[model samples]
Target: MIPPSSCGVLVVGSGNAGFSAAISAAQSGAGSVLLIDKCPESWTGGNSYFTAGAYRIAHDGLASILPLVSNVSSEQAERIDLEPYTEADFARDMRTVCGGRSDPELSRVLVEDSGDAVRWLARNGVRFWLSFNRQAYEVDGRTKFWGGLCLRTPDGGKSLIADLQASAAQHGVTTSFSTALVDLRYQGSDGVVATVRCDDGRRHEITARAVILAAGGFEASPSLRSQYLGPGWDMAYVRGTPYNTGDVLELAVRSLGAQTFGNWSSCHSVAWDASASTDPNAGDREASNEYTKSGYPLGLMLNAEGQRFVDEGVDLRNYTYAKFGRAILSQPGHLAFQVWDSQTSGMLRAEEYRPERAEHITGRTIEELAKACADKGLLDAEAFVRTVHEYNEAVYAHRRENPSARFDPSMKDGLSTQSSGKRLSLAKSNWALPLDQGPFLAVKVTCGVTFTFGGLRVDPQTAQLLSPGGGKIPRVYCCGEMLGGLFYGNYPGGSGLTSGTVFGRRAGRAAAAAAAAVEEEGDLVRS
Candidate 1:
């Protein structure tokens, strides 16, 4: 096989972040840009293809959202009521969800520039729509959107990947799939050399004036998951591509002395169907994130011991879903069951109701539910009944105190239960309801990881990877899940995609500038 020598800018991993970097580099005057991915052409978008395509942007109201939303008729815009999600709210959400571990500078940049980053994607041909299916619900006669999550890439992650790749192609960005990076060698003031293996089993060295590593985190590799995330993480199902084996992270940190940040044990995980496929490349994939049971916030989560492990109503699903996976993993048998009644069952996302896809159990009464759970060998029947009885007493007491109060699923509507003398270790913060309603529903789930948080620390300003000595690594930059210090402990939903665009754009511009400088100073282009 003939080996191509070099390019102006090389982007590793052709997902949202990689494509964003390549397109921006090409548009910013870089003559040649190439993006390579380990996956073949069919599975090339990385984890972004599995995402919900949601983007968290800081906007003032429906009026300000009009410019960003696509195909919104004036009549529909006037009819919908969208609460303002300001910059302050964005920063507060990041800090709160990460347990105040997020870097202040990175948080500020993400919150302040999120709107512009989203608009930039829209300008680059990625389409957008109000997240009607996943985010909002209809109330009375009108549509009311809540949770500060309004924008989404239409048709979900698959469509987002298609459009971004199309934009990359339109702007003359070259893509090489099935090319895996094996090693990276940095030359002191010269540049970085990437050793890659192509589909033909041929190895080649590709040198570039600047490198933007957006390959992703270590969630897919079982060994890395066990090494960084601790003991039982290797058993958890991955919600994304298996190709993110921490190659770039290892090369940058161990080989180039890059500093790493964020909580290594923490990652963005969720309660996924225990029946889901562990194979990322499986064509008949049973649980490819369509199995995410996010409706636990509207119900109760009981572990195998027939005990509640987490306050399911502590916050919106967007704010708490990422961290609850740890709770599920810590449970006995590494499983949890989300129990809901007919009252809120209809409110669940359509994904939860797929007959062939979910591990669902239904019963007409609480006792029957316990029997069904016991029949499945998932929980103790007596212990489950006792737990339900105690919880229902609390709900009844709370309702008796406020007879006129009604349950609202749109937001944290202060629907909570009182202990009523049966004190439990964990308390439901809000949306607490009784299981007295018949025909109860329960879905079994285990922890499913999305992406690891701990990664190479970088300067958020230029997206340049920083060294252990607190200096830039010459011409190397990083983006996406590989850029650390922005999230820890937990992650607010939709921030991942938004941060990818923000840092990806910045890294691309910086990389293009660096490549141009090299050409000017040496008066020679290494092709």
Candidate 2:
């Protein structure tokens, strides 16, 4: 437990950005750097612990064989690409996705140093996926391992979070969890923080030299959501734990005259929650058409009104799938059922939970499975049968009338969730499970936000926090989503891991340099 009067480079939140900031601040040479979060060490701090850890680096080291997507003269890709993609094309695609607000320098740093950043993790005693021993960025689809990080081995951010925590301990960085930040005290016009208040109904008045607001977004604050996102709207907070409360943002504004942005905006997330494994055919309903056409495509989605609003079968980024994720929260019971057809192709198989073993699957007579699910207490079976029939009529009518609709030709890709070779195509067939299938299945799903997207804003080059009037907040630095624009809100697939690593290092080295300077001057010297 940290004493009420403790001081140093104070860091808030224990998620990815917070961890990154704390470690970076400590290395920056700040004396007595402290890590504090709203939750105890026992529970997960926030969504970062459950992320996929996919960092997008445009080209996975293929600059040579292929011209850099930008200038033909560039070298092969990252030299480690297990999958095929060009850096230039990836950059173009991301810029296009960002609709132009992404900071160029930040993006450049992320794309350029992402590999080195992951390698740094390897240097920090973090576990590698290769312990079982196949290999890495040298391969294509994977990179630095998270070990038994936060969750199990497969997911990425969990390990990154775990690594940060362990590294903090090894470095002698002090941490106190389950403590809430209630206010921030600015020392002078330079915008330096002098102290912080806590929610233990007490205040922590210390002579802190710097502070990093790694406190996560307000996705969990129902009041904030109602005030900012929408009245009926709530975050997918239930998708994971609820440590994020916009505590820093709210506290900063309410107390220290801190300026904040992105409070009114909420990023896109996934809208399906597969509770109740009782539906024997549950696995099939999760892959969207993009997954069906590609491999591991996500399943179909429907709104509360039982109407398919999105393509229903496309892969990630077809349209900010995150926006549709909000659709999950808007549904009745904040849940909707993802249904699937009995496609004999083993291609749609999900290793997470195998559906191939269901002998009860029927290829026709759609409502039979609905009755079964209702009997199993998963849905109002009769209503489910009706919903399926309506979906079939819509599909048949659309195909007959507009067979040549907007779908891209490659949507028919015979393989991969990220498209086959070049562009990651979007597929809508995830919506095409004909009601004729007899043993159809449904799984309830809710909004699944990968992680909170908002936090502090930082200067591009220095990675330092900025004040409301729009100037750098001296002595205060932030990186990762804790800063801004790198993720650029909707996420470009793979940027999270990339941003965390890049920003983490920048903050670390900067913090280290700062600490060294402070010690030399005796300004932050020991009492």
Top-TM-score candidate index? 1
TM-score of each model, in listed order: 0.95, 0.71
lDDT of 1 by residue, 1-527 (tens): 33356888999987789988999899998888989988888887788888888999899888888887776788877678789999999999998889899999988999998999989999998989988777877776567887889898886678789899999999888888888888888654456788999999989888888999999999998889899999888878888887888988888887778899878878998898877764632212233458788988778999888999888888888898888888899898888888989888878888655677777799999888877887665658788888888888888877777787777667887767654544456778788888878789988888988899998888989899898889888888999999899889898899999999999999999999999887776665443
Tens digits of per-residue lDDT for model 2, 1-527: 55435445667767666666666666656667777776767654455665544444433433221321221222332222333345565566557666666667777777677556655555665543321111121113323221111111233456656777898877777887766666566654223343444545555654455666666566666666567666555534333445565666666556644445432455545643344234311112222111111121334444444544455554333334545666566776565555566542232334223453222223245566555554433345555566656555555555555445442212332221222222212334533434454344454455554445556666666666667787765556665444556444465655665676677667656655554564455543445
**In terms of lDDT, which candidate is strongest?**
1
Superposed model 1: Cα runs more than 4 Å off: 1-3, 71-75, 187-190, 278-287, 419-423, 524-527
Error of 1 at 152 (Å): 1.1
Q: Model 1 — which ten-residue stretch has the worst lDDT?
A: 280-289
* Span of 10 residues, lowest total lDDT, candidate 2: 144-153
- Candidate lDDT scores, in order, read 0.84, 0.51
